[model samples]
Target chain A: MLAVQTIADGLVLGGLYALAAVGFSLIFGVLGVVNLSHGAIVMMGAYLTWFVWHTTGLDPLLAIPPVMLVLFAFGYVYQRGLIQLAVDRSSLLASMLVTFGVALMLRNLLVLVFSPDFKSITPGYAFNYLRLGEVTIDLVRISALAASLALLGALAWVLNRTRIGRVIRATAQQELAARLCGVNARHVYGMTFGVSAAFAGASGAILGIVLPFAPPDEANWTLNAFVVVVLGGVGSPSGALLGGLVLGLISTATSQLIGPAFPNAMMFLILVLMLMVRPAGLLGNAFAASR
Target chain B: MLAEALARHRWWIALTLLGIAAAAVVPFVLMPFHVRVGQMILLSTGLGLAWTLLGGFAGYWSFGHTAFIGLGAFAAGLFEVNALGTEFMRTDPLLGFALGLLAGMAACAVAAALVAWPILRLRGIYFAVAMLGVAQVLSELTNSIEAFQGSLGLVLPRIPAFGLRTEAVFYYLLLIAAVIILAIAFLVKNARIGQGLAAMREDEDTARMLGVPTERYKITMFVLSAALTGALGVIYAHSLGYITTGSVYRTDFSLNMIVYNLLGGIGTLVGPLIGAAIMVLLTQVVLGSFLNLHMFLTGAMLVALVVAAPKGIMGGLAGTWQSWRRRRTAAP
Candidate 1:
């Protein structure tokens, strides 16, 4: 019964992790640039949702769409304005450094605005719980998990079926060829960043209900996304889902078996070991065939 | 051959000696705060040079060089506190310190060696992130494990030497460390191994095909750099007179080391020194009053630096001079 409960909890957490990581994975896959400030974007989403809920007394889950829209615009402008400039001016690694700098700036801004304290959203159903057989789960967690899966499903569908998605993938495989084929590679890149940021923001909203968060949590989220990408493979929603599930399971198992303090150590240990054993990840890069 | 090599770089050697002489008198002439700043500049320069051995010269940019820093500090701290005991440390504190420093360096070397084989196989970003994971794991271990006492923190013994003030003593020690690091960096840059490393940086597979012993050179440099960084960390821990995991395993220290190299000129001996000096002065003196804005300003500076001068100060100057020379020749 305890094991079953642990597994259920892991699945819920996994859903959140997948949602959090998908944007970073997509950016890495399509743009070939590790967006180091990804966590800040996620945090921005959470904070925005919180702001909306705080001001209007609206439900947190219902605020996700507006928060995501704001983030999409922010991500689009950020990519086109700053990231594009960095990529043009310097090497990819140097561009990564630019993102690092931006991350620090954004984090500092967050601290100034939000004050480094942990904030969480508590709705009307905050204390409700569901009991199925011998297992019990919170209503907020179940909804958070459901929301995460729905978002991931939506992302997967758009990428698989949409015209813009195909253009982004083509640009990722061959930027020049895509340009030759009448695709504005830069615009597509911006759109991909926008989509990524929207998803990140949605996850952040869900995360706000599940876990308390502060400005500094941005670093952990970024690192978590990197680990997810490394574990699940790069560039696809399915890969992120797989990686997130495994990571969530591992984290839950570590805390259950050893102690809560050991999960981060275990996560990083697994990260290094995974990189050494299979640099391509379990599923491998989605666009590896194109390369 | 040694004498010939020395004669060839006579002017460079003289300038270095002159700089050292000037630096030596800094504690005597400056305020205590300035002397502390000098100590920081020296420490940063040493760390930057150590990082350059691998990151700049070998093209293996590590995002977690602070692993060695934290590891060295804790290793020495544990040994000094537990193994040597307070009685021995109190009796002959200098010898205890020397032994602790050696132990710290040894720990770092061993740790680097353990990870080098699996890690060195990774290229580019993989290598960087793997190093980051290493640092993160080590710090987490230090924090979680009660034996390490990282959460509790450890206090270091005060080094009583030459009847000098604490800041002055550390300043001299850091100066010595920086000079030693600079000397090692200069020697390595001119050596045969340096040539091999240059080729490896250009193209690792091709360098290996050309019989450059790339693997051996990389491991050697990694161990050497880790050991040197460990030594600096020990001295820094002593200067602090206390240390926690947070103090030694700072991500900012790792980032600053890279920034210094990038700001001055990557893969150059003098670049880190110049970069460290500029950054220390900028942060400590110019922007010191704006405590909360430090991160924002540093980030802004980094973004501006990358966009405007990607090749750094030395590279930009060299480029300008080269263009001028080309124009002079082309006019005729």
Candidate 2:
């Protein structure tokens, strides 16, 4: 029964990790750099959702769309304004450093407004748990899981079916070829970045429910996103989903088997092991193939 | 003709001598707090310079370089507590100090070489993130292990002999360390190994095709840097007196290294020194009320530097000079 409950909980966290990793991987897929600020975007989304809940007393679930939209705009403007210049440099390290810079800015601004103290959003139903015989799950975790899976579904649909998705994928595959095909390179890149940010924001909102966060949490979030993307494959969304689930289980199991401090260590160990054993990751081979 | 060249460069010679003299006497000139700040600058500059050799020169960019630092600190602390008996550790801290630093250096070099050999093959972001993970794992192990004092760390039994005059004692230590780091960096920048690293940075494939022993060169440099950085960590831990996993195993130091090195001029010899000075000032002076704001400034500076001048402060000036010279030649 305990085992069943632990696995179920791992799946819930995995769903959340998948949502977080997808946006991060998408940005990496479309753009060569691993948008270091993706976690900050998620952090921003969490704060925004918390704000909506704090001021209007709205259900946090309903707040995801507006938060995602705002984050999308923010991401678009950020890419067009600053990163456009960096992208031209054509160095992965430079772009990653650039986003690290933006992340620092965002983290500081968040701290300026919110202070360095940890904050969490708990709606009335946050504490409620759904019990099913030997298995039990927190309602908040379930909602986060459901919300993330739904968004993942929507993202998968867009990437596989839609025109914009196809353009974004083509650009990822070959930027010059895509540009020659009249793809409006900057616009497509900006749109793809915005979508990626929106996904991050949604994940952030869910993160607020699952855990308490301060300004520095963004760095950890970014690290986890990287671990997920690398584990899944650099440019694969479905790969991200699987990676997230695997990380979730691994982290949860580590916490259960060892101690809480061990999970963070385990995540990195797995990452190191993966890089050494299979740099392409479980689903990573398609990364260079597409991007 | 040689005499004329010497006369023309007289100002540079005078300034260089003047700078050395000033550094020698700085302990007496500044107040104790600022002396501490100077010590900070020396430490940061030293760390940044060490990082420059690996990330800046070799183009590997290990975001987990802090792992070496944490391990060094832990190794030093463990040596002081476990190896040195309480009696000897208290009275002859100088002996323990020397041994602690040596232990830190040996442990760091071994760790870096062992890890770098396998991990360096991954390339780019994977290598960077993997390095970060390595650091995180080491830190966590320190946090969980009782042998590491289990997050409480260790208090170096303070022998007043070691810090009879805190300002003079550490200032000289830091100054000497910084000088050594800068000197080694200058030496490395001019050597055959340095040229190999430059070639590797520009294009590994081309360098390899040209018969550069890129693997051996990278591991050697990485080990050298790890030893240097670990030595710096020993000094840092000693100065602090009390060292803990949370305090010593700071990943943020890795970020600072990257930022400072990049800000100063990623590959330039003097860039890290300049960058570290500016960063230490901001961190110490303007830290309390505006801690997060400082972070914002650091980040904004990074973004701006990368976009407008990817070469950093020193690199930017060099770029301008080259461009201006080209323009002048073409003006006719």
Candidate 3:
């Protein structure tokens, strides 16, 4: 029963991780550029949700679509104007730096506008929980988990079946080849980045439920997302799901067993060990082959 | 010809010497607060160069170098606490300095080895994130540990005579270290290993195929970079007369170092130094007045520079010069 409870908790957290990691992995897969600004986008989404909830008394979950739309447009414009310039450059390091600069600007902008206050959207049912035999589960966590899995499934289906998805995957594999094959590679890349931003926006809405939202604290989320993506395998969505679960479980389990301080260390240690043993990651080779 | 060349370079060297000489005499000219700021610039320059070894030369961008800097600072602080044998003891400052530097380097090397194992395998942004994780974990561990003073941080034994005690001496010491590091950067830029690093930067697989031993070079450069940064940490701790997790493990320092390197020009020997000087001066002039607006302006500047002049200030100047020369040559 205790083990079941832990698993339940892990799965809930894992769901959030999955949402974060998948968006990160998708950006990497489609563009071959790590969107370092993804976490900041998530933070922005969270802030937007919080603002709507506070002002209009709307449920945070209900605020997702509007937030997603805003971020999607931002991502589209950013990529077209900025990221495309670096696509041909040998080092994506510059892109990462640029995004980091953007992130710093965004974070400071938020701080200036909102101040460094922690905010959360606590719906009327925020504290509600369901009893399952001997274990209890939070309704919010369960919903977040379900939504995450459903989103992941939808994304997987889209990538496998949809024309746009095909174009994105093709571009990921070979940009020039995709271009030669009559695919508007630039449009696909921009759309893919927008979709990635939407995923992050959705994740942000969910994260506001799980944790309090702090504007400058997006750096933590960004770092954690990076670890999850790397651990899962860079460009694999399913791998991201598994990686997030594994990380969430490891972090949760380690925190429970040893103490809170050791979980981060253990997670980093695991990452180091994994990289030493498998540079391509457990699920990365297949995607690497595709690329 | 050698004499002529030496004579020509002499003016440049003299100007540098004169600058340092003026800096050394700054304690008498400026307020103590300004002197402290000067000390910070000298210390940060060492750190900026330390970051350049990997980020600029090897093209491995580490976003968590604060772990090394912090570790170095704490190790030095610990040594100071024990060696002085008094809460306020300032005796045998030289011994404290030696121990602090050695411990800083040793700790950084070990931390680098630990961090490098997982992070080095990942490329680009993944590597940067992994480093941040390492730094956060270390900071948490440091915060939880009791002997390291936990979250409250460790206080160094204050030396007698505030002005004459250590800050000025540490300033000169840091300045000397910076010059040595600059010389080392020049040597590394021209050496076989430097060539290997450049090749790897150009194309990793091709460099490996050409027998560059990419991993060895990466780790070596990472360790060397950490060592220099650690030394800076020791100097920083001694100059400040206190050590805390907040001061030591600052992410802003890491960010500033990266900004400095990029703002000056990447993959250039003098770039980090130039970047550090410009940034430090900017901060001193601008941030000192408008603290809140500083970050906003810096971020905007970084974005603008990346878009407008990706090669940075130095690179932009060189590009303009080359274009002018090409046009002049074509006039014939």
Residue B247 of model 1 has an lDDT of 94
Spell out the clash pairs found in candidate 3.
A272-B118
Candidate 3 displacement at residue A188 in angstroms: 2.1
- Cα shift from native, residue B303, model 3 (Å): 2.0
Interface RMSD of 1: 3.0
Worst 10 residues of 2 chain B by lDDT: B156-165
Error of 1 at A246 (Å): 0.8
Residue-pair clashes per prediction, in order, are 0, 1, 1
- Per-residue CA lDDT of model 3 for A65-97, tens digit only, reads 898899889888888888877544424767777
Q: A170-197 in candidate 1: lDDT tens per residue?
A: 9988999999999999999999999999
Residue A164 lDDT in model 1?
86
Better of 1 and 3 by TM-score: 1
TM-score of chain B of each: 0.97, 0.91, 0.88
The alpha-carbon lDDT assigned to residue B8 of candidate 2 equals 71
The C-alpha stretches of model 2 lying farther than 4 A from their native spots are A287-291, B1-18, B159-164, B282-289, B323-332
lDDT tens readout by residue for model 3, B144-212:
877787488787754334456355666677888887777677567667888899998887889999999
lDDT of 1 by residue, B1-332 (tens): 44666789899899999999999999999999999999999999999999999999999989889999999999999999999989999999999999899999999999999999988877777677678778877888898899999999999876667788989999999999889989898888888888899999999989999999988999999999999999999999999989999899987787788889889988988889888999989998989998897777777878888888898887788889999999999997
